[model samples]
Target: SNLETETEKLIQIVLIGQPELDQLLKKNELRQLRQRITISWELLPLNRDETRGYIQHRINVALGKGRVQFSRSAVELIYKYSHGIPRMINVLADRSLLIAYTMNTKKITPKIVRPAVKDVGGLNPLTTWIDSLWKTILPGFLALSILLFGANYLMLPDFNKKNVEEKDLNLIIKENPIIPKNLIISNSQAPIIDLPQSGNLALEKMKPVTPSHQAYTPDDSLTTKLLNPRRIPSTKPLIIS
Candidate 1:
């Protein structure tokens, strides 16, 4: 400010800060500095029309004029969620583009923008109101419903404890009668040692107990030798004494 005053207001120094900067500048210690601030402008959020234009301008610059398109509803939703903030608008727009690209669509609609807004961490006015309403009313509604149900249940007459009528076993069996189908029976070529009475017995009888050569032993000499196991004299003669 002094430098600007010395130079006859030729030099300009701009001070930029958040919304709270105004409160900070109004403090007693900074009164002189605040007074010297000739031009004081609060950066206000863009209105609906300006927001739409800003989004369109960004789209045109990033992806040529006609390459991508945002639907009217999508733009409105973006404006509502972003509250006309350019940074948030950019974030939401980028996410919407990504969602549309993933879905293989060129046009962005509200359906595409809604999830983007949620992911970008902002809810439009209507959505915020609805969410709050649910939070406020749902528990009360549920409690009322439960109370009504309980009252209705208590007002009802006592139920009879008598046993229910037994169904007719014969009628039920007859209604759902089991009908046997014609079963195919195959014959075996091998000679039968005994007639099998059951499926398991038939399977066991069909299995070969021994090989044909082993089953047809001419004599029991091998069996006798294995059973006796007698020791024979050695053929060497030097230790005969």
Candidate 2:
């Protein structure tokens, strides 16, 4: 009965040995199920010569099981990038094959692999980054320049001085009196007119005498007539007193 039970369990067992396959089986097992599998192996990565052979084998398989050629430099570049990982070698070889097909060539070289890898991962130079930065900043710098020029024009003292001078000229012209041509005295040099010292004496000397008073006659209607003219005059008489 024990032998029958052992045979039955052995029939139920599934064999798993590959590293990737074992990892999957371990992940899915219950604790009781996990204890049943005691046998395992830790797979190691390929060495340099194995890596080279792996890369060549994949390239040959991609070329329909025929030989695909590669330069020593190209093999070196592949080894450098893939670093002895079988999966990475397969990925790079597949890409190199596609590049060879597109370029219409059977041989893959370092040049072909370089451009293929570069297409996936490439970096710009520092100069390119700096140039892009300048492009972004240029418009702001230009606008600041324009603003400064406008401010300078507005603040200039010469412009203010000219404006003030024009206003002053207009004001000066407006305030002076207008003199008629006939009233203006035309003299090479203006004459200095002198007056007498005393105000009353100057006034008396400048006064004009009447002609009738200056023409007085004492003989015509005598002194006696002059004294009695008003009493004796039935007619009007002219007398000097």
Candidate 3:
């Protein structure tokens, strides 16, 4: 409950900062206490010459009277960046003093002020952001591109077959027919011995007789008499009987 009360007070304070605070206060029971406020001031930014004067005054106060010095170029840059705003002028003046002290110089130049503003505000160039993005994303994109190119190449029809050479031994054999020796012989002549159609019966049933059963005679006439023995001996035998 205490925290809620504190939160409500903070919200009231913020709401009062708005232009409608007078109308809102009429609705609240604490209007008498809120209306007791007497003085108010609305702060506004300084003009360009006033901005330069403010910076000079702050620097002179910090470094003792007539002790510190600044170039015209430095004062012009401060006016340009602060845009005649008193708050911004104070900030720039303080930073410039610090830079002058560190560098052991009495003059606050535009160069020193620029770097100090960038350092405090964390300003980054657009090109630098772009370069960082490209550095992070380019390699992956290039790798994917290479992979896509390879896929496309594989998907395409193979038209690089001009280097291929084919040899046909069957075609060569057909162009030059071979004729066997048996096929060249005429039918009127005896058939070739090596072929199946020779029809030579001597070669089909030829058998060798054993030496024990073979008839042998010294002369051709005896061989013929042995083969066909005469019947004269049979006549002599019948007479004796």
Candidate 4:
């Protein structure tokens, strides 16, 4: 390949394909074709702001003017549905223009953009709802599933396991004490005692009693102070309300 004649002209070839198809062409298969190629480039779509500028530039070039009128909201809608791709933007912009023209709109507006989006079969609401549902529902469902799985794994018996002996099928059950419903705290036939005429047992109990005489003892350890006790201070008798 390096011993080419001076009269022969060297030609280079460029190949392009989608990201998915790139792996189909192996370096070994294209060795001869790509022998002279020293560089390769990968291009990505523009972002929302960049897409807006891109659409405006295309519109300006097509109309032979510095600017083409597009409402802010309309531009945003276009960017949202187009996903900031140049070719997708062109397609949506063309469709939107057609819709605007038919609807007698001088400049593209959000109202025009909506119908245009719907007409061209834009994003599906059901699919969007499903996506949102997956984001919100799936995680919570999975968490609950995980918790249940862990609990079952920890608490429940494994049916497939062979560790348990078939001969010992009876499991030990705990027995609780049984209480009789008819049991009573006291004997039913027990006689009731009558209250005193005063009907105040606490008052009767609190009443001070007269001091009785203590037996005489000649013990030196027992002083007269011990034999004769100090007088207790009198308190008002309690009156039941």
lDDT of each: 0.75, 0.63, 0.62, 0.67
Give one digit per residue, the lDDT tens place, for model 4 in 1-241.
Answer: 4545688636545677555545555568876656565666766877778987887888877883544478888888888787666777787788888887787756888888888778878553223467889999999999999999999999987676566554344332213325443442343343434334442343355544554675444444444444344544334333223
Ranking of candidates on lDDT, top first: 1, 4, 2, 3
User: In model 3, which residue pairs have backbone atoms overlapping below 3 Å?
Assistant: none
| Root-mean-square deviation of Cα positions for candidate 2 versus the true structure, in angstroms | 26.0
Off by over 4 Å in 3: 1-34, 122-241
In candidate 1, the residue pairs with backbone N, CA or C atoms under 3 Å apart (3 or more residues apart, or in different chains) clash, namely: none
lDDT of candidate 1 over 22-65, digit per residue (tens): 99999999998898888888767777899889988997788657
List runs of model 4 lying over 4 Å from the truth.
1-38, 64-67, 122-241
Runs off by more than 4 Å, candidate 2: 1-33, 59-67, 119-241
Better of 1 and 4 by lDDT: 1
Q: How well is each residue in 152-224 modelled by candidate 2, as lDDT tens digits?
A: 9888766566677777665675587475555555543434443334543444565445597586444535445
TM per candidate comes to 0.44, 0.37, 0.36, 0.44
